[model samples]
Target: MEDALWAQLQNTGLEEHDDKDRIEAESDDEEVDVQEELSVPHEERLQGPQTGPKGVKADHEYHQQKKLVTESKARAEYNARLLAKAPMTTTYLQDEANKDREELLILQAEEEEEDDLKYYREKRLRELKNMSRQQRVFGTLTTITADEYADEIDEEMGDIPVLVHLFDESIPTCKLLDEHLRGLSNKYSLAKFIRVSALQLEFDLVESPAILVYKNGILIANLVRIIDEVSTRFDIDEIEDVLTRHGALSENDLYDLPTNYA
Candidate 1:
C-alpha cells in the first residue's frame, strides 16, 4: 500500500513538471511573434489593422476627404481677405478717374481763355492800324500856287484823285466855289483839293472858276466856263453829282471817312 501511494505521488509530480515546461515553451513562442510584429515598418503596421479590400478603400476615401476639406478651408480664407479689400480698391479707382476728369476740364478752360485773349488782341491791333492810317491822309482843302501845281497835284497824287480849281479871286462865283470845295475836302478826305490863280495860268476872266481833275499824274477832265456848262446857279449837290459822273469821286470813297463826319 505504501509503494502504491509513493508511486502515485511521483506520477503527479512528473505530470506537473511537464505541464510547466509546456506553458513556458508556449509563452516564449508568443514573445517571439510580438517582437517580429514590432520589427515591421510603420506603413505595414498601419495596413495590418485593415481586414480586407473594403476597409482599405474606406480608409483611402477618408484621407482623400480630409485633404479636400483642408483645401476648401484655405480657399475660403483667401476669398474672405479679397472681399475685405474690395471697397478700398473700388474707391481708389474712382478717385483716380475723378482726378483725371478734373484735370481735363481745367485744361479745356485754359484753352478757351487763351482763344479769347488772342481774338481780342487781334481786334485791338486792327483798330490801331486804322487810326494810324487816318492820321496820315489829308482831311481838308489846301491852297497852292501855280509854281507848286506839279509837286502838289501831280507828284503827290499817287493813285488818289486830285481836283485843281483855277479861279480869279475877284469873281464872286469863284469865291463861292472855294467855300464848297473846302467843305468837300473835309467830307471826302480820300480826294485831294487845291486852287490856283487863273491869271497865273494866263486864263481869261470870262472863263474863270475853271475846274481840272487829275488821277495818277494824268489829266482826266477839264471844264472851262463851268457856270454855263452846268446849271446857272448850282448848289454843292449838283457839283458833287458832276464830279461823280466824271469818275473823279465815288460813293465807296466815303468809307474811309470817320463815322461822325457824315
Candidate 2:
C-alpha cells in the first residue's frame, strides 16, 4: 500500500509542474505579442481596424470629430483676437457712419457756395449791362436858348455834370470849340453838353468862346475867354484836362464811358 501511494503523489506533482510550464509559455507568448503591437507605427495600427467597413466608418467619424474640434478652437482664437483689437463694434460702426455723413455735408456745402458765387456773378453782370445801356442814351450835344437854360440845364442837371458852350457862330475859336464839344458829348455820355449864343446870355462878344460847368443845378465854373484860359490854340485833350481839374469829369466817369466810343 505505501508503494502505490508514493507513485500517485509523484504523478500529481509532475502534472502540476507541466501545467505551470504551459502557463508560463503562454504568458511569454502573450508578452511577445504585446511588444510587437507596440513596435508597429501608430498609422499602421489604426489602418489594421480601418480595413473593415464598420471600423472604417468609426475611423472616419473619429477624424471628422477631431477636425471639427480643431476648427472650433481656431475660430475661437480668431474671434478673441478681433475682440482685443476692437472691443466696441457698435461704437466703431457709429463713428464710421458719422465720418461719412460729415464728409457728405462738407461736399454739399462746397457745392452750395459755388452755386452762390455763380448767382452773384450773373447778377453783377446784369446790373453792369443795364448801367451801360443807360449811359449810351444821352450821347449827343443839344442847342439851348437863354430862356430854356433854367429848365434844360439848371433843373435838368441833378447830380450829373453839365457843360455849356457860350459862343457866336461867326467866331473862329467858337466854331472849333463846337466841334470839340460834339466829339466830347459822344465820348462822355454821362455829362450833358449844350451850346448857346453868347448874345443870348448877355455876354460880351469878346468873350464869345466861354465855357460854363454846372453840377446839381449850381454853376461850378465859368471860364470866359476860353482861349486865354487854356492856350491860343487848344485840342480836345487840353479841354478835357481843364474840365477834369475842375471835377467836371472824374476817373470813374471816364472808366464808365461807352466801349464803342474812342
Candidate 3:
C-alpha cells in the first residue's frame, strides 16, 4: 500500500510538471511572434522589391515624392532668375526717362535762345538802316554866304514886305544881322519857319539845315535877317499898309505854319 501511494504521488507531480512545461512552451511561442513582427521589415528590405498592386502603389508614392522635389527646385531657380533681372530693368527705364526729359529741356532752351538772337539781329538791322538814311540825307548840303542874297534881302525884307529872319547864331552870315535884327520874330503871326545848318534837314531844304519854310513845297516866305522889334519900329498896321501898298501880305499869299517846334 505505501508503495502504491508513493507511485500515485509521483504521478500527480508528473502531471503538474507537464502543465508547467506546457505553460512555459506557450509563453515562448508569444515571445517568438513579437520578435518576428519586429525583425521582418529588415528582412524584407534586404529581400528587395515586393509583389502585386501593393508593390506598385509603394513605387508610385516614391516617384510622386521625387516629382514634387524636382518641381520645387525648378520653381526656386526660376524665381531667382526673375529677381536678378528686376533691378536692371528698372534702372534702364529710369535712365531712358531721364534722357528724354533732358533732351526736351535742351530743345526748349535752344528754341528760346534762337528767338532771342533773331530779335536782337532784327533790332540791330533797323538801327543801322536808320543811321544810314540820316547819314545819306545829311551829306547833300551846300554852303551859302550873306552877300549872295544881299539884293534879295534888301528888296524883299527891307522896306516893302516886313520879314522875320530865323538863322543859326553860330554862322558868320547870321552874326552880321546881330546889330540889325533884334526882337522881330514875336511881332509876326503869319511867319516863316526857317532852319540854317550844314548838317541836318529835318524841315524842307534838300541840303540842310538851311533857311526854309515848315511846309515842304509852299513858298509863303523866306527867312531873312532884320534887326529890331520891327513891328514896333513901324506899327504892324502901318507895316501891313506898306506891305499892301507894295503888293505883299495879300490874302492868297498866306500859308499854314508848323505848330510843332520840335
Candidate 1 lDDT, tens digit per residue, 1-262?
9999999999999999999999999999878876776676755644434333347775776567667768999999999999998876767789999899999999999999999998887776576457547543455677888789888875654557888888997888898888887777767777788888888878786845888889888888777676865687667877787778888777644524444331
What lDDT tens digits, residue by residue, belong to model 2 across residues 28-137?
Answer: 98788777767878766544443333456867865776677689999999999998888555587899998999999999999999999989877766765687666533
User: In model 3, what is the error at residue 17, expressed in angstroms?
Assistant: 45
Best by lDDT: 2
Ranking by lDDT: 2, 1, 3
Which runs in model 1 stand beyond 4 Å of their true positions? 1-136, 205-207, 255-262
Q: After superposing candidate 2 on the true structure, give the runs of residues whose Cα lies further than 4 Å from its correct spot.
A: 1-137, 255-262
Give Cα distance to truth, residue 54, candidate 1, Å.
Answer: 92
Q: Assess candidate 1 and give its lDDT.
A: 0.76
- Candidate 2 achieves a global lDDT of 0.76
Worst lDDT 10-window in candidate 1: 253-262
Ranking by TM-score: 1, 2, 3
CA lDDT scores, all candidates in order: 0.76, 0.76, 0.46
